[model samples]
Target: MMGALGQSFINGITIGSSYALVAVGFTLIFGVLRVVYLSHAAVLAACAYIGYGVIEVTNSAVAAIVVATLAGAVLGVVIERIAIRPVRGQNHLIPMVTSISVAIIIEETLRLTVLSGQPISYPDTFASTVIRLHVGGAEPYFTVGQVLIFALTLALVLTLRVVVQRTWVGRAMRAVADSEDVSSLLGVRVNVTSARTMALASMLAGAAGVLLALSIGAIDAHFAEPLQFKALAIVLFAGLGSIPGAVVGGYLLGFVEAFAAGYLDTSYRDLFAYVLMIAILMMRPQGLFGRRLTQRV
Candidate 1:
């Protein structure tokens, strides 16, 4: 039982790292645009498929990953320029609805063309190597994929943190997030900042899609939906625009699901995210790191 529990804990951390990556990307878009871009889920799914095709053609995981990340970056700019930008001018809420429409369209396109609406086995070549881990009286094994996921998630997430907190682009993003008018006056190109933020966030999503595909061992048009919702839950749990908070929330949810599935049934795995989110909402609507508005009377 202890060994099983320990394994679950490890699994949770690995899964949580991916969750944090997705949540941070989701949060970044909200920070700049102040709107929830639901189409992000579609972008992530599409990138995973793109990666699959790349791997199929090149027979190289590295190529797949690179192509997927680049594809996501391009799609981010495209969506920002085409779909979101047009509706964004109308109202902040308008983009949310418009993005949903875009997401649906992308979903349908992928289903009809890619799957004809059926799930397929994900490539396991990336995760074929198995390494045995020595523990106290319990031999917990590790896979190349799991180790890769943890390492890449840590490195990428830390790199993102540094870029956000210590770079000119980070400053511009923070400035725009604070107030577009003020940022513009300060010589921070607001439009450019928004586009860059989208590209950066979407790239993370792209990387995450590959990691997710490697971990899950199967792919489908809508497989990313649950993960997307879980990412939203992490975003809310960490607060609306708190990138660090999202990271923490991602790992927390990951552990939660891991333990729950370890001791209980897999059927209840997805249910806990909504329950946890609801609990967080009831307990702290502002989130763990969210700032409350203090309006002057």
Candidate 2:
């Protein structure tokens, strides 16, 4: 009983940490762009596939992660220039539509070009280690994969925090987030900063995707679709433009899904997330960490 509960909580945190990493990128883009990039999930999926393919060819996860990050960074810049830049000053709705269209195009192209006939598996380098634990009177153990996930997640989060809060680019990003016009007037190069922000966000997403592939041991285009809603729900629940908020929201959502699956049924795992999101939205539209806006007449 107590052991099972403790194990469930640990499982929840592990799943939530991955979600937190992915959600941070989503929240960052929204904070800087002020427009929802629906293609984020698609980009993440593509990066994962690219990483898996590279690993298959070179048999090196490190090499694969590097290549995937570069690819995602370049693709993020391209998407910003072509699909997002032109509609920058315009209403967010236009950019939102454009992003969705780009998502569909990317999805179909991946399906046609990559999965022509066969599917691919993301071979794991640490799949053999087994670690078990006994707590109280119930059964719930941990594995090396779960341990690796936690370590990778912690490293990524710490790296992001340091980069965003300690580095020069981080200062520029904060300035832009504070006020784009002022940042531009002060020689911040708002356009470049915004593009760089998108690139960084994409790289973060790529890292999360690679971690996800490592955990699941398979790569497929459709694999990222489900993540889209879950990631978005976390970001929205935490607050659309708050990075830390997204982290908290993601963990909460992850735990909810894990507990629901463990106690109820696996089929309703996603249902729990959506239901929780809807309930939160209905009760507090501003989200858990979002600031309440004041309108000026």
Highest-TM-score candidate: 1
Best by the lDDT measure: 1
lDDT of 2 at 79: 85
Q: How high is the lDDT of residue 79 in model 1? A: 83
lDDT tens per residue, model 2, 59-112: 777777788888888878888888888898688789889888888888777878
Report the backbone clash tally of model 1. Answer: 0
- Per-residue C-alpha lDDT of model 1 across residues 3-25, encoded as one tens digit per residue: 77778888898889889889999
Candidate 1 lDDT trough over 10 residues, lowest sum: 120-129
How far is 285's C-alpha from truth in model 1 (Å)?
1.9
Residue 41, model 1: Cα distance from true site in angstroms: 1.3
